[model samples]
Target chain A: MQKDFLELIRRASCELPADVIRVIKQGRNAEANGSPSRSALDDVIENCDLASRTSRPICQDTGTNIWYVYHPRSVSQMALTRDILAATRKATRLAYLRPNAVDSITGKNSGDNTGPGAPVIHFHEWSRKSLVADLLLKGGGSENVSAQYSLPNGAIGAGRDLEGIRRCVVDAVFNAQGKGCGPGIIGVGVGGDRATSMIEAKEQLFRLVNDKNPDPVLAKLEKTLHAQCNELGIGPMGFGGLTTVMGVKIGARHRLPASFFVSIAYLCWAARRASVSIVGGVATYSQISQQALKYKLPAVAARKGR
Target chain B: MIRIELPVSEKDVRKLKVGDEISLHGTIVTARDAAHKLMVEEWPKFVEPLLKNGAIYHCGPVMKKTGKSWKAVAAGPTTSIREEPYEAAVMDHYKVRFIIGKGGMGPKTLKACKDVGAVYLHAIGGAAPLLADTVVRTKAVHLLDELGVPEAFWEFEVDGFKGIVTMDSHGKSLHSALLRKSKKKRDAIIGI
Candidate 1:
């Protein structure tokens, strides 16, 4: 199981999921042939291919190692956590992950990627026989640009309603610009406390980029915000082109009347994440976008005579 | 694709303007939050020679130890904004010619680019593996024991390392321009 966990980290670190690759290619195609946006996406596609082929990390940052684990009653949470930490340390030693955990108070690195709260894990007991773990490597660059807004704020003229939610998200994207690494996938959370709002927002990122929300209202908001963000002309890397974002995912939770918090998680084009499930000693990894791995942009392929 | 060698002349960098795509070939140094802070706070003299007319990349790379030396696995630009407070001072003190990073710097850094004859080259953030391939060799390392691998000053010889001139010596910034344009659009959408 630990070996399977290590492989999960490797795959998540080195490979861009297929859907992310597809949207990036779409973003590139939307730009002019010689535009900077197109060229940036070209570099991204090339980087994806190189990282996966070499089994190197997709980005040097490697990001916060977040884990969402689900297991049956047969498994022990303590043992699972111990194994995960051991695997994280091993991954860092292998260069699959950079040593990211820092001691905030002491201003010292843990040397390994583990500290008091590092490699944050949330475990849930499930009725299923299989044990599942999903990992997300949320890069610091994108995390820096993520925003949260409290409603009834006069700054953006937002109130505690859906209209206010739209305003908050749009404002966050605008402020992020290219700094969040444009052509971003936005995950929005509405109607929770500040902390839970953020978690809910980040959780939305675990969904496939093209997946629609079960709630029609939230889905509609997602579609609307998606188009609105791209219309800002931020483009890829904020170079000014047709595409600014590849997807917008929104999730909502019931909140107290006194507080309406909206949190935005801006995931970069890298979007490093993967999942694995083990049942009866047999482990299965989620399928990465193999089609994306082999894809070469037409213009680039033509120039290189591939 | 404008190509410039590292240790570039101010005259060559002056010719670069906003929106110009560039490829740098030569020695470049990696420095992020901790390094930048140290550069400004302590005014490290050792880095002056390397940074003078040379480039500083805002990066924290995944590196593997190969015997006594190190090899970069994934080296990509990090967000440059966090270094905003310390950048201008470092650029002025070191006479650094190029700052390769993502996102953009603040107004002081923009002003310092003109005053110090530097330009902010915006590398594609998250495009690490491809960028790492450009590294010819890891030349040397400093402050490794103090700052750890990610925040240490890693010197590398690179060929065809690429970025866009988002901020130039002429007092222009592609980032600010995009921000202004995007702000208006955001206001319109939010009805603010």
Candidate 2:
């Protein structure tokens, strides 16, 4: 199981999901010929190709490992954390991940990629007899651009309704400009406390790029935000062209009466994430994009041996 | 597009203008936040000869050990704005000719570039593997133990590394212009 988990980290780091690749391709096609945006997208596609072929990390900043785990009550959290930490160290040795966990106060790095709160794991217990783990490698550049907005603000004329959310999201994207690596995706959390709102926004990134929102109003807002963000002409790396944003995903949670926070998590085009479910000791890998599974799964053979 | 090789000459760096595409060859050094601070504060005399009139890349590469040697797996540019506080001083002290990074720098760094005959080159931020392919060999490493892998000073012999000149030695900055333009667009979008 540890080896399988290590392989999951390798896959998530080296190969991007199909949905992200699809949207990036669309972004490339949308750009004008001879524009910097087209050239930038070309470089990204080439980088992805090289990373997948060589099984190397897609980006130098392999980023912080954020794991979402769903397991049965039988599985101990301590054991899960231990296995994850071990896998992380192994992954760092393999160069599948960069050592990113740094001590905040001392400004020192934990060279093995494990620190006090590194590889943040969110575990949820389920009734099913299966254990599933999902990993998202959120890079620093995109993470830096993420913003949280308080509603009923006069700036941008934002009010408490959905229109206010739209204004805030757009402003966030605009302010990000090309810094977050545009032709990017936006994950928006409409209602929650400060911490939960940010978490919810980040969670929205786990969804497939083209997946429709379950709620009609949210779906419409997603579509509108997607179009408007692209219209900003921030383009790829802010060189200026069409297709600034590829997708806009929105998720909402009930908020307290006093707080109305809208948090936005800007995800770069890399968007590396992968999942695996172990049911009855049979590990089955689930990709973020269902349409395409082009990369060869090295772990499938390991699972077969089990 | 212009093809420039390192260690870049001051004359060549001055000739570069904003918005010109560039491809670099020869040796360049990688440094980020920690390294920048170290260079500015400690001012390592041992590295001065190697860095003089050379390019400094704002990158924390993914490196793998191959026996005694190291290889770059993914080497991409980091956001340069974070190094704003220390960059001008380091550029002035070291006589660094080229600053290779992504997302651009601020006014102080731009002024230093103009004053010291240096230029800021913008690379594609997430194109790590592609950039790594351009690295021919790892030359040397310094401060690895103290600053960690990403923040360590890694010298590499590169071939045909591509970037756009967003800040020039001639008091021109494409990034600043773009920022102004984008602000106007944003104001119009918000109906301000």
Candidate 3:
């Protein structure tokens, strides 16, 4: 309750990580100067950096976050919801993110980054003392293409196999092409109720690119998914280039085997947002907004090709 | 660099080829998703006065305030294919002869361009700050209060609005041709 939601929002909005900044700049420079001025591999890194520092959003579409609060109890859920939104608006404004919300039916702009029933916050409680709120700052480009299919056991026979997920992700991103501001990251949520699987798919984003899933099988899926997504050749900004997905992440849960949903949530390179002060009564939490990341952007030109 | 005029004849548009960059001047209509939907379905009667073989820029500008006036900052072209469903109708209905946007439109729009003597130009994406420089002045801005500046029609006095020819009246598209050529390179990299 003590966490200042407004301050948290401001922090989340205005700032982003140096690495993210570095990559977005990389993308912008790649575009401005690509061989029409450039090369594919170099452009990918450049766009990621340009998106970060040009202070222009990595892509103009700085997406909506589908926040999931896996709370230990109901006591803090109210503040939990309030805190994240406050943080979302603040971080969005500061990041120089574009205002992207609009009424789907009426075509009226929401004016702020928010509107009615927006930033859908789903809460679940347990006896544990801590609160962990995971946010997926879902961008419109990729989100437009998020696919969920309730495959018959035969369709995805192994509960979840690498090929199906690969096809799903690659096809998903490929379909997005220039729409999702490509060179996106796709998260696959497997083995849950339809909605939960979708929710968990987004959670994988909090884990960062190239991070391994504790489950070794899921880890393999991530690697394979990452490789295949690139194979689509959607490329950076869909200019017949390479390095489409920086990585693919999967979040899995063991659910009743009778029913399963392969929920895939897509995130563009500009995966923006911050989490500060996940609380449990007297216990406190700090934050992980990209801007708060205390590392310098690595020069990966030499490493990019290899 | 090619220079094209409005209401170009099919023979003239067909003379242009993909990869030939051009600077276009003269009257062009501006529209995106909202304006596109209206024009395709049934645009307002007032809109009739606006269309004259004009260019449709797939943009929604982020504006800034200048000393005494307001100016667009980042006005780069957005992906134009999103308007594919309504593109042909808008082209034929309003006689929109040119489409300037990033990425390219699909087959139907390409066909319409060829039949209607139009061309789809591919401007560089993410070059908004630079692209914003070509816009010299805007005349008779409409719908600023209704659909916001972005969805509104901003007729401009542009000089050297640079764009690459993606699709021409002969039904050619650089975006597709680039993909086919690159796919072989991508496939060759496979195998040990």
Native-contact recovery for every candidate? 0.84, 0.70, 0.06
Among incorrect, acceptable, medium and high, the docking class of model 2 is medium
- State the TM-score for model 3: 0.73
The TM-score measured for candidate 1 stands at 0.95
- Model 2, A1-306: lDDT tens digits are 787789889999999887688779888998888877799999999899899999999999998788988889999989998999999999999999999999999999988889898988998998988888888999999999899999888978988999889889889999888888777889999888999999989888877777777678998999988888877778898888888888898889999998899999999888989888888878777664211122122343224421
Give the distance in Å from residue B65's predicted Cα in candidate 1 to where it truly belongs.
0.3
Q: What DockQ, between 0 and 1, does each candidate earn?
A: 0.82, 0.74, 0.24
Best model number under DockQ: 1
Q: Compared with the true structure, what per-residue lDDT tens digits does model 2 show for residues B5-102?
A: 78878898899988788999998999899888888888989778777999899999999888999999899999888999999998999899999998
User: How far does residue B61 in candidate 1 sit from its true spot (Å)?
Assistant: 0.7
Badly placed stretches (over 4 Å) of model 1 are A287-306
Candidate number with greatest lDDT: 1
lDDT of 2 at A219: 84
Higher-ranked by TM-score: 2 or 3: 2
Rank order by DockQ, top first? 1, 2, 3
- lDDT at B60, model 2: 96
Minimum summed lDDT over a 10-residue window in model 2 chain B is located at B183-192
Q: Flag clash pairs in model 1.
A: A18-A289
Q: Give per-residue CA lDDT, model 1, range A129-241, as digits (tens).
A: 98888888999889999999988889999998899999998888888888888789999988888999999898888777766666788889999999999899999888888
